[model samples]
Target: MKDFSTEITYKTSRSSGAGGQNVNKVETAVTAIWNVMESAMFTFDEKLRISEKLKNRINSEGLLQMTSSESRTQLANKKIVTEKMLELVEQALFIPKKRFKTKPSRGQVQKRLDNKKKLSDKKENRKFKF
Candidate 1:
């Protein structure tokens, strides 16, 4: 995961869900915003890749915004925001190692040839004389 020691800025807003009267009273939900261009944690190349991969999550100003209201506490929501940010960074940084092309081994080639010869012999024996 990318080492992001930067503190993400968040604004609290009430969520519209089945939370009863307490939902309307308390603004425990957290909405965090991190501008990809302004982030000091990621390099230019890393930011570009992350922005492209997470384009759907970013807003018009190229800010990666996320909201978490799963819990009733602001601290819990803040933790969720951090988790989400780390998750996105980890996903964007993942690069599959390239595989080297390889030919069939001699044992495998011989096995295939033997199977073909066995099938040919079996077919030859199945023929009926006039």
Candidate 2:
């Protein structure tokens, strides 16, 4: 896992979940923010790639927002938020290997041509040639 301690920032918000009275009272939920544009963890190229790939998840200001309300306890929620932040950063940092172009095998190409010919023959047989 990548280290995102310096990259990400966190904020607490009131949780709306199965915490009963605690949910309404304490701000236990965590909202993790890691702005790709402002992050030192990723390079410019990586940031651009992340911004493109995770456009939906990013806010208008280019900050990636992740919220955690799975746990009632603040510490647990904080941990979850931290882990998720790391995962998000790692995803952004990843460089996917380029795909190599290749042609279909000779046998597969022949099979496809044969299938096309069979289909054409069947269609032609359906028509009563005048």
Candidate 3:
């Protein structure tokens, strides 16, 4: 992904899931925050793209935040959060190819009409005689 490592900041907190006694003792969960508005690594257009694409994840302060709690160690959780943030940014920056509109082929249209006619004939044959 685009190098935005300098723009990221990490915070650790106690993981909330299953870990028994370790959950209370260790701060394993990591939150990665990226300040999109203050990022020097992104251009105005790039920042706009990210902000628009990831609006749900961004807070009022323009910080994009992600969390990881799968790992037992803070360092592992930090790595996972950072990777996830990068993946999210890369996905936001991607522009999908435009769809080219096209009409159905003559053969396809004719096939559909034929099937409709067959169904109509079958239904008519099944009608009760007067």
Candidate 4:
């Protein structure tokens, strides 16, 4: 993976709620945009993987866009967005380890059979004798 830090672009808008007059005057909400298709951070295959995994978050323009208004400061909001982007990209790139099938051991199988036998006996005892 290449350095994605250089590729991110940020936009700001007025934050909503709880900041009183300060919210009206400042553009503190930060929106981070990174174009997956145009990114040099990954190969074509990796880009495709990212696009597929993040299809819902990505727009029609091929940009994976995220916003942060959690912090009152623009820099803090910007930091949050960058962290979100990093986490999302890492998740998209992750490959799950393949699973291998295994059979139960003899002791495990015997335990299951013994439990079933006990349950059967319990039910048999519950039925009225005829």
Candidate 5:
């Protein structure tokens, strides 16, 4: 994974889900925010790639934010949120292999036609003739 720690800023809030009274007193929910435009880790092209791929996650301010509140401890939540952000960025930067389009061979086309004809024959036989 890339070292994005320098570009991230975290905010903590009280978690909303389970955990009894501990939930009320502790700020275990963490939100990690990173500005794609301001990041030094990625080049201009990489920044553009991330912006395009992760456009939904990034706000109008160009900040990519991820939140995690599953853990009870603030530190644990922070780690989870950071990991989530890293995963998102990594996915955004990934380039899939291009697909090569190819036509089916004569044997394949003939096999498919044969299968269709067999099905049609079976269906035709199932019909009740007067």
Candidate 6:
């Protein structure tokens, strides 16, 4: 993959939570935006995978936007958003290993049947006889 950071764009606004006067005065919150479809880092298939995995995060215009306001400084929030976006893209590209189904052993299956039978007999014994 090429430099994903190169294609990223950022927007800033006043953060809502905490930071007291800093929050109200400065635009500390950072919003990272990247065009997933237009990104040259990944192929079409990989872009498709990313879009599918991050459907909720991607806007109608096809821009993947993420916001971070954890820190009081704009730089910290910007760094956080970049890292967050990279991590998400990395996760989306990963392909999980296929699981092979296994059947229960014969002994285990027989034991299960025996346990059922024992329970049935115990229940049968609880009934009053004529």
Top-lDDT structure, candidate number: 6
lDDT of 3 by residue, 70-119 (tens): 98888989988898899999999999999999999999999999999999
My TM-score estimates for the predictions, one after another, are: 0.78, 0.70, 0.88, 0.90, 0.85, 0.87
Off by over 4 Å in 5: 116-130
12-64: candidate 1 lDDT, tens digit per residue? 99876757898889898998888887888878998888888899998899888
Candidate 6 stretches greater than 4 Å from native: 1-3
User: In model 1, what are the clashing residue pairs, if there are any?
Assistant: none
Better of 1 and 4 by TM-score: 4
After superposition, the stretches of candidate 2 with alpha carbons farther than 4 Å from their true spots are 103-130
lDDT of 2 by residue, 13-73 (tens): 9988798877779999888888778877667887788888788899898888888989988
Ordering by TM-score = 4, 3, 6, 5, 1, 2
- Number of the candidate with higher TM-score, 1 or 2: 1
Q: In model 2, which range of ten residues has the least summed lDDT?
A: 1-10
lDDT of 6 at 99: 100
Top candidate, metric TM-score: 4
Q: Comparing candidate 1 with candidate 6, which one achieves the higher lDDT?
A: 6
Model 1 earns a TM-score of: 0.78
TM-score of model number 2: 0.70
- Candidates in order have lDDT scores of 0.85, 0.84, 0.92, 0.91, 0.92, 0.93
Clashes of 1: 0
- How well does candidate 5 match the true structure in TM-score terms? 0.85
Model 3 scores a TM of 0.88
Q: Once superposed on the true structure, which residue ranges of model 3 sit more than 4 Å away at CA?
A: 128-130
